[model samples]
Target: MFEQKATEWVNSYSDMLYRYALPRVSDSDVAKDLVQETFLAAWRNIKTFKGEISEKNWLFTILKNKIIDHYRKAVNRLTDSFPGMADDDPYFEEGGHWAKETQPKEWGVDYNNPIEAKEFYEVLEKCKSKLKEMQNAVFTMKYMEGMESEEICKELNITPSNYWVLLHRAKVQLRACLEKNWFVK
Candidate 1:
């Protein structure tokens, strides 16, 4: 009976989980592995399943944790220092404003238009891929997952200041990438 139910869950939730994880991890194979891992975990803990939430939500919660774990592991494997985190950031000036040449330009795209938005997202993903691993994780957790600063700090095992610095660097890099690739083009 438990095996049957587990199969049912795999059939039902695998696609949704894959879609949820793909953009976050930015890799199809890793996303599939995470989904498989989520199912394996849910199966192992089947005895603890309660009716407090829908089965789908529970599976999603598991998948979300799996994604967070992926980020945590990637962060732990970092060997090189992030030069973008240095105190003398290139994007900002002495007074913490955008440097004269670094000021943002008008995107001039209709965000509500689905076609343009999709194209913009494709470009954004390319830009995101260029960010350092820690910056990508922090940026995704804070902006994509809408997680709080404290929660992100706890999850990534970084100090609050470090979290802020990573977030700032990610934004600066993303903005510059977009400006050059999307806005100017």
Candidate 2:
């Protein structure tokens, strides 16, 4: 019975899980693998299914953890490459304000307009792809997944200060990329 139910979940939830994972991981193969892993994990832990939550929700939760694990591995790899790299505040001044030259320019985008908003998002995705692995992971977790700072720090095994630095640098790099690619164009 558990095997049948798990198989049914694959047929029902695979596409949804794939869609959820793809944008987060930005790789079709990785997304598919995560979905497969999620199902495998659900099947192995079938005895734990107490029905407090729907099977779909439980599967999604498992997939989310898989995605977090993916990000954690990527972050670890990056840190391993550049051990003890300093997180310098290059974009801020002594008073913690944006440095004169680094002040953000107005985007003047009409987000309410679907066409413009869509174009902006396309540009944003391109910019996001340009970020370093760790910065991208941190930014996506906080802004895209809506994960809290504490949760992200805990999951990523990063200090709170490190999380803030990564988020800040990601935003700074993204802003610059958008300005050059979107605003200038």
Candidate 3:
């Protein structure tokens, strides 16, 4: 009875679980792991889940715990991971709380004007040059490469705290630089 229930639960809830998990983890692999782990955990503890909560609520509660576990493990792994040059490094991982809430979208730049393009690139180049080496790298890795804090931390051999500080400073510097260089026009 327990096996049948667990199997049916998996069939019903796996997709729902993934919908929640994938957005948090961003990587399909990690999302899959989280979903599978959530189910296994639910299977083990399902009996303990009092009738006060519905099965969906209980499963989701378990999923939430699993997500938190991922965050804690990722934090621990990131804290300890250094000289970790693999492309798979968690440095740029997207699941951290520090990850951007808003994804970049097409902000229609009027690119038809050759002079405008040149001027824009020139201003950006000036802004780029003004940043400290680490700031420049972080900004490039973030804005250009679109890496998340987790991956950037791993890639740059820095902690999450360091990553966020660099990003904040980089944004401030770039904004000031752009205002000085470009907004004048």
Candidate 4:
């Protein structure tokens, strides 16, 4: 009976679960792991499954919690295992962090700038391609995906300050990268 219910749930939920998990985790492997863990958790807690929440909702809730828990555990392990790693160390920090605390150019954004959308997107792509792996990852999670720093830290197994520093460095690198790659012509 447990196997039957589990199979049925997997058949219906596999693709749906993947869709929900993929964008957040980015890697196909981790998304699959999350989905599998969600199921294992659900199977173990089947007796406690309350009818109040829809199965889909419950599964998703379980998956999200699992994701957060995964990050938390991973972060705790890393932090607990390592010590005296100064965040001030320049190794992880990248370009243009100085501008983050300031206002954008006083010239201001002109959304009506007549540039073609394609050209704009190409420029963005070019800039993104030049970013360091970590910079690009943080930028995607924060900007493209619209996640807040707190959530991103929780998900990526980083601290709030690390998130801010990453965001700052990403913006800086993006600026210099764009200027060098796109605007310097």
After superposition, which runs of candidate 2 have C-alpha atoms over 4 Å from their true positions?
1-7, 78-103, 111-119
- Model 4, residue 143: C-alpha shift (Å): 6.6
Instruction: Report RMSD for candidate 3.
Output: 13.8
Q: Is candidate 2 or candidate 4 better by lDDT?
A: 2
* Candidate 4 local Cα displacement, residue 94, angstroms: 9.9
What is the Å distance of residue 165 in model 4 from its true position?
1.4
In model 1, which regions exceed 4 Å deviation?
Answer: 1-4, 79-84, 87-102, 110-116
On lDDT, who's better, 1 or 4? 1
Candidate 2, residues 53-109, lDDT tens digits: the string is 998999999999999999988767763532223545656788888877667888786
Choose 3 or 4, whichever is better by TM-score.
4
Clashing pairs for model 2 are none
Runs in model 3 lying further than 4 Å from the true structure:
80-185
Deviation from native of the Cα of residue 21 in model 3, angstroms = 0.1
Query: After superposition on all CA atoms, what RMSD does each candidate show versus the true structure?
Result: 2.9, 3.7, 13.8, 7.0
Instruction: Return the clash pairs for model 1, or none.
Output: none
Models 1 onward score TM values of 0.82, 0.77, 0.46, 0.55
Error of 3 at 157 (Å): 18
Across residues 1-185, which tens digit of lDDT does each residue of candidate 3 receive?
87788778988999998977664444578879888988888777766888898888787878766765664454455544322222332222355322242222333445574445667776776676666555555666677547687876775567787677767766755665665566543
Please, what is the whole-model Cα lDDT of each candidate in the order they appear? 0.85, 0.82, 0.64, 0.67
lDDT ranking from best to worst?
1, 2, 4, 3
